[model samples]
Target: MEAPTVTALQTLKALVALQEIDVRIRDLEKDRQQIPARMKEIDKLLEEKHHELSEEKNQLAEVELARRMLESDLKAEKEKIKKWEARLNEIKSNRDYQALSREIEAARKANLGIEDEILRKMQDIEDLKTSVSQKEEDLNESEKSLLEERTELKKKLDSLNADIAKEESTRAESLGQIDRRWLAQYDSIRKRRDGVAVVPVLDEHCQGCYMGIPPQQYNTVLRGEQIVTCPFCHRILYYAKSLEEMSEDKA
Candidate 1:
């Protein structure tokens, strides 16, 4: 609770400032690490879409092949009917001619049925082609949008890298401003306390743990004199106003 030397107050300020930078660095690094996983998810989605499209096209191809085969069978049936018709004039008996005419009639009926089926198959092929076309268009649009999103993530990753580098470039100077004893203590506490070695006292509560501090300790922190730690959390403390003042001075 005693008055703090100007040097001690400055050291406290330096620790607070350094904590801000370290927290930012940790967050940015975490976000940077997640970009690859996100990109992989995007790629997987695209792959699934492509597989669906390929299956549709394959079905369309199969249907078209079936239609062609039907047409070929119809042609063969008509040729057989034509050859049987040509034998009618050469037949001498009535029964023979009647039998040959019945054969031609049956062949014509079969060709008619084949023609109907071919028409239906053609319609199915057309429907499938339309569906595949629509799917391809949708897939292209999705790819464009996802690729844009991926590009934006890349830009964000680059921006975070730059910000981290800028903050780190100044970290050494902040470290130099602190008393070596306090700096050593801050590093030790940060490791043990989840990277939060310095916290602000707000309304007589330790921001780190949200636990109430002793009134005397709160008053000591309010004066911005001497480094204090929360009794419950044992993390170093500073008055919130002191940090604001330091920030304003820099601005």
Candidate 2:
């Protein structure tokens, strides 16, 4: 016994359906591949925010430490001025007394300059405190927004995975219906031609490559009795009919 013959139109229809499934899978897989990259981007953003916060806190600590050291120095300078004033009361020579008075005046001026610097440091500390507070708030808001975005991306990835699995099952069934010879040729062409193995002949042109078909080949495709390929692009070509014509034919 011999196997029954499969018509060209039947194979073409099967291939068309298979193509639709394959394209859907391709798109779903593409989307699935992007999820990891997007997640990585979110992680990078969070890391940068954390680093900025850490840096600000470190700088604030350093400034506070410097302010404490300045305060200690001021205390030491005040003690020295007190001791020098006590010595002035005990001085007896006029020239020695005059030199001591000028020294006291210079020390007072230096103390005033130190006081001004301490005030600036205090202001700087306050400004840094304000900045740290704002950044903390911003980080909190970013975490909330990114968490929502991550949740949405995970949902999308799960949905895409489910869709891809379902389409693959359908493709398996479609493959079973197609003749092995046709499937092999279709797969080969698809691999060589950017995932488009089958195309419709529309207006005497290959819809896949948009290349014009010769008149004789176009006529042959219209007969729909045998497999035909576009001469220019080597894609399997099917004659496309309007819905009305297809309905009339069915009628």
Candidate 3:
């Protein structure tokens, strides 16, 4: 079979517009895929905040329990001190009185320690409660922002989908007008070259690989005499006219 002529190869350039549309569709689909992951990331963040708040609450409860226990101990010590003083009146022996006096002093020291502990625990619980309150507020704000972001992304994704569908329909119609054999060759080359099988000739250079063409190849391309593949990259090549040149040619 004769190698396809350069005029015939030029027809493949029509596919470039189709490729642009397909690229846009792929990009939109990529954006759509990220939407769910982004939402999931927000959900994960919220769950982390909730877990942190729960831990803070538990710490507060523990501190409060400690404070209550200390309070109970202090009250018991005060009651014992009152009982000891009342018994002092009935004590006749000096040794018994001295021993009761010592016991009262020890009870007083124990009461002081318990009161100090209660104070420390109360402070800790207060601090923890404040922290938990702040975290809850932050979590609420973050969730609200995430929800708003999700809504906006959904609207944008829907718009992109609509655009893609319209472009795809147009691309299909354009593809129908192309020759079957040429389309097959285009598809075959595109598959091998990552969706770029056709490239423009600019300034005696192959845009596909930025390689300079020999004089012989350049003349052939200018004449539109025979199809030429880039010697380095093997892509189908064609010339692209500037808008002014195209208009002049039409006149």
Candidate 2 pairs with clashing backbones: none
- How do these models rank on lDDT, best leading? 2, 1, 3
Best by TM-score: 2
Model 2, 79-195: lDDT tens per residue? 999999999999999999999999999998998988998999999999999999999999999999998999999999999999999999999988877888778889999999988
Task: Estimate, for each residue in 1-251, the C-alpha lDDT of model 3 and write its tens digit.
Answer: 32344344335455556567667777777877887788788778878888998988898888888888888888888988999999999999999999999999988988888888888888898899889899989988987898798788778878877887887898898786556766676678778887787787889999988999998997776665555778888787776553234447658
Estimated TM-score per prediction?
Answer: 0.77, 0.86, 0.78
On a 0 to 100 scale, what is the lDDT of residue 147 in model 1? 90
Instruction: Select the stronger candidate by lDDT from 1 and 3.
Output: 1
Q: Over the stretch 1-251, how does candidate 1's per-residue lDDT look in tens digits?
A: 22244455677788888999899888888988999899889989999999999999999999999999999999889888888888898999999999999888888888999999999999999899899999999999999999999999889989988988988988877776777778888999999998999988889899999999999989888887677988998888988787678779879
Question: Which residues of candidate 3, in runs, are more than 4 Å off?
Answer: 1-10, 165-174, 179-194, 215-220, 223-227, 242-251
Candidate 1 Cα deviation (angstroms), residue 219: 5.2
The segments of candidate 1 whose C-alpha lies over 4 angstroms from its true place after superposition are: 1-6, 30-34, 92-105, 179-195, 215-225, 241-251
Among all windows of 10 consecutive residues in model 1, the one with the lowest summed lDDT is 1-10
The ten-residue window of minimal lDDT in model 2 covers 240-249
The alpha-carbon deviation from the true structure for residue 244 of candidate 1, after best TM-score superposition, in angstroms, is 6.1
Which has the better lDDT: candidate 2, or candidate 3? 2
Q: Model 1 residue 145 lDDT?
A: 98
C-alpha lDDT values of all predictions: 0.88, 0.88, 0.77
